[model samples]
Target: MKILFLGDVVGRAGRDAIVARLPGLRRDLAADLVVLNAENASHGFGLAPDMARAFLEAGADVLTLGNHAWDRKEIVPYIEGEPRLIRPMNYPPGTPGRGATVVDLPGGRRALVLQVMARLFMEPLDDPFRAAQAELARHTLGASGSVQAIVVDIHGEATSEKQGFAHSFDGRVSLVAGTHTHVPTADHQVLEGGTAFISDAGMCGDYDSVIGMQKGGASIRFWRKVPSERLAPAEGEATICGVLVQTDDATGLATAIAPVRVGGRLSQALPS
Candidate 1:
């Protein structure tokens, strides 16, 4: 199965770029599933139900959230009922929505999507490593009652923590991708144990802005410390940053891993 994981979608520009380019991308890559980080999709905050639906309609199979998952209060109910949407799994026990779910693909294959947040440089949460291990164990490939493949989205700040988590579940899961940094990492490869891993997938928004936020506004907030108004999306060429992973059916292990970039300042795509 071929899977495409996109990083944080910042705002209107990001959403438009995804909708405009995803169909061609899906065709070119022959992607079987597409997972997108939509924590910042709605005006760089939380995702509204309408925006979430738009993302789903634009070829996203599942949507993942990060620290900004609850920015929009109205989404609480939708999050609880939407199985295709996932928030950080390591959140406290009584969180509104689930952290993992099984999505059945076209070929009768089931893919497990799990999201976890790290503690370093991020809000403290349940032990992400332990949480991942338990989840992977439940969906181990080839196990009597296992799912076809397991994909993990590690939303965190520290690169070390993301790397450690990926290594910990090397063979147990099919793919482990990172998010929240909004900056794509150069490392993209299949682990020794067959899992596809990347430290960060990058952001899908304006490249000229400061991490997808308007530079002018962000600058003021940084230097003045006064509540300069909320940052808006930059108006310029947009880009889509993500990774493409191809997994083997028999063992549910990654066969290929490559970074994908299109439009904006950094425009490049993986070799077919």
Candidate 2:
């Protein structure tokens, strides 16, 4: 299974890039499943239903959200009707949308995609580990099992927590990629148990600013401890960042993983 997992989409810049390039990306990478995190697609916070529809139409098989999942109140009703859009599984019991979804591909294969949020320096939610374990227990993985691949997006602030969560489910899932940090890390590698992992996939937005936000306003909060103008996303050329994982057909484990960065400021990286 070839799985492509994109990190957070930070604003109009990110949304535009994905809409314009995702079709070619899916073809170029030969991705069987494409999962994207668009929590920040709307003015740098929360995703709008229209944005979700655009992403899905542009080849994203599933969309994931983070702490700002409900920032756009309209998404609540939209998400209820869209099974492809998911939020963190650890959200309290009565949360609106689902946290995981199973996508059946063209070749009669299925992929399980889910997102979990970390508690360290993040919103206090249900135990992510337990939440994931409970959810995963329902599905079997492998060529002959219930699903051919499993992808988990760990959205949070601490890299330590992301790494820990990836390790905890190392052998069970095909890939465990991180998001929310918006800065791509160079630690893309397959674990001992065959799971592909990266501390972060980075945002699909402009890199010239501060983690996709306009530097001037974002930096103001650091310089002074008072309220400042609303922070907006940098509307410059965007660099679409993500990771592509190749999983073994029989075992549903990752055989190779590569970082993908296209356009804008970051050094280009594409599967060869």
CA lDDT of each candidate? 0.89, 0.96
Kindly provide the TM-score of model 1 when superposed on the true structure, using C-alpha atoms: 0.96
lDDT of 1 by residue, 1-272 (tens): 88999999999889889988988888888998899999998899989999988888888989999999999997899998899999999999999999998988886778899999999999989999888777776666832336777889999999999999999889878889999999999999999999999999999999899999999998888789678787888867788999999888888889999999999898687756
Query: Judged by TM-score, which candidate is best?
Result: 2
TM-score list, all predictions? 0.96, 0.99
Give the lDDT of residue 141 in candidate 2. Answer: 94
Query: What are the root-mean-square deviations of the candidates from the true structure over C-alphas?
Result: 1.4, 0.5
Which residue pairs in candidate 2 collide? none
Model 2 reaches what TM-score against the true structure? 0.99
Q: List the residue pairs that clash in candidate 1.
A: none
